[model samples]
Target: MFRRHKPSSSEHKRDPAIHAPALPHNDMRSFFSLSQLVLSAGHLKPPPVLRHSKTTYFEVEILDAHSKKQICVVDKIPPSSTLLDVKHKFHKVCPQWSPSRIGLRLERNGSYLRDSVNIKALAASSIITLYFTDMGQQVTWTTVFLTEYTGPLLIYLLFYLRLSSIYDAKESARSLRHPVVHLACFCHCLHYARHLLETLFVHKISEGHTPLKNMIKGCTFYWGFTSWLAYYINHPQYTPPSFGNKQVTISALVFLLCEAGNHFINVALVHQNQSGNKGSFPSPSINPFTWLFLFVSCPNYTYEIGSWMSFTVMTQTLPVGVFALLMAIQMAQWARKKHQLYLKKCTTYRWRKRAMIPFIL
Candidate 1:
């Protein structure tokens, strides 16, 4: 056989599509080089095409919270609609329902949805469902409080005036009126009167209604306590405190100071709330009376407890002391709750801040 002609080295080098010449037989280096070339070309394969599902509008269904009956289906609600906007749209179909009296929830028994939440903010599917509950017979918190406080103020004065036949006439004639007793009556009236004024004007209480049952319970507590305390304080046989005039003077002064401080704190707190600076730690300003906030998270409760303690000292009666003690316990509970709320909302709150008392509690 004729000898095969070999291609020149220049021809192999010049051709772009020329395959490499055959590797030397059983040469491991040449075999490895061929493997590397194959691996380098693998990236040329096209990546799998990615598919996405787009959502434009949402479908919403409303159901009664209690019976789980389907109220209506809302088709094609835009993402920009707020919860309040949805409520208004629901009101159009259901004429019996008012927006203020309607509470909507995400689940059957879940907490009501806030009006501020937007439909787009929720991680909802194409179909969104909301449960509705009827919020019946609403009254403002200020109205409820004013009603409760007003009753006690007038009822206590009835006892103070001795207008009711509750006291014995013969004993009343023999009983000597202590100056401290008159002072206590004046202070009690002043306190409740101030509360009424604050409820009407100074406080920027939120525009929310309290339940009828809660209003009843609050009235019972306040009116009942006023009767109980006023009965003893205004009694004909009531005697001067054991420590006499000196104790009365000092306690009365303390009571006045604490009452003034409490009013100031309430004003400051109302101003703070109105300023829309919630979720921030409260600090003392130019008002020195509010400086108690430096040590206690709830200085209002501190001053409240102080006022009651002073009253207990001035009266020096078992009932007054017991009332003061009970009030302290209740106020401490309120203070602890407020303190916890402050801690949760305010990142910069002082770790050493007490609930009500300074340094001790």
Candidate 2:
């Protein structure tokens, strides 16, 4: 499971090795910055073992910045080794530098690369420092969703809540991210917030922060996205040029259906997941039935698109429209990727489904 690597910095000034073994003091806190520790934690993720081993192994050259020298040459590396792993080996030699502190770069099949990609399991190397700064952000992900338009903001909130409720633990982490999430998303978000702290740290829980207490937070977290939308729509003294109750009602119905669909799909996948069946029968953790169709179908993604689309239809605001477009594109990209992974990994996988879209696409 582990390989021994030679530590030789080809570039840096050669300093005397500390052969003296005093206290193995835990100054890793000193050597590793906060971000570095998190990066290391993330880097600890092991590669998914593939069925076949590729030939034509690549030689990754590790450059030592100190001496401006090309130090060690890593040979016969499996295609499975990530650019990050290469840098990790480099760091072993260049102990004076962490990935965050070095000028690492990757040359993949002799080309400079950008973005997160799996290059057909080929021979390539990166300037460990630069690649990881970009790569780490991909692996450690967190972002808040906000709608530019106010009317359909509720729909966005519902969409976010629907996705997050499945991974409820993330909400508690969000409390550390922002008190606003703790204060006013919606009763649902607050419910999850309470669920999180109680699930993890019960003794230090607070009643005021309970999802029930933060009605405003709950509303904003789910629907109160555009502060001005509600004000303009429900103003007591305001009069509308024309009212379209039928259109509004239909949009609301679509939004509700999407919300329900997302909730059920996640529940279905979670229930059917069998990730622990490594011995006799194979099992997946949240195995879904979306792959049965032709393209790589992700029903959750379908619901997500629908939810946002409903928001756009209801609000008809430029910001909501743009956000919906971005979300749809991103969701399609994700669904395609997952479908591809399933196709590549599973012998029984069927490729008839077209992502979130049905056969027409």
Tell me the number of clashing residue pairs for each predicted model: 0, 34
Best by TM-score: 1
Candidate 2 regions off by >4 Å?
1-61, 64-68, 71-139, 142-243, 267-296
- Candidate 1 lDDT over 179-284, as tens digits, reads 9789888888887898899888888887755566788888898888888888888998787899899999999999999988898999888878877999887678
In model 1, what is the error at residue 100, expressed in angstroms?
4.5
C-alpha RMSD by candidate, in order:
11.4, 28.5
TM-score of each: 0.76, 0.41
Candidate 2's residue-wise lDDT over 214-257, tens digit each? 44344453454443333332222323222355555576578767
Candidate 2 local Cα displacement, residue 43, angstroms: 57
The stretch of ten residues in a row with the least summed lDDT in candidate 2 is 137-146
Q: In model 1, which regions exceed 4 Å deviation?
A: 1-60, 73-100
Model 1 root-mean-square deviation: 11.4
lDDT of each: 0.85, 0.47
- State candidate 2's TM-score: 0.41
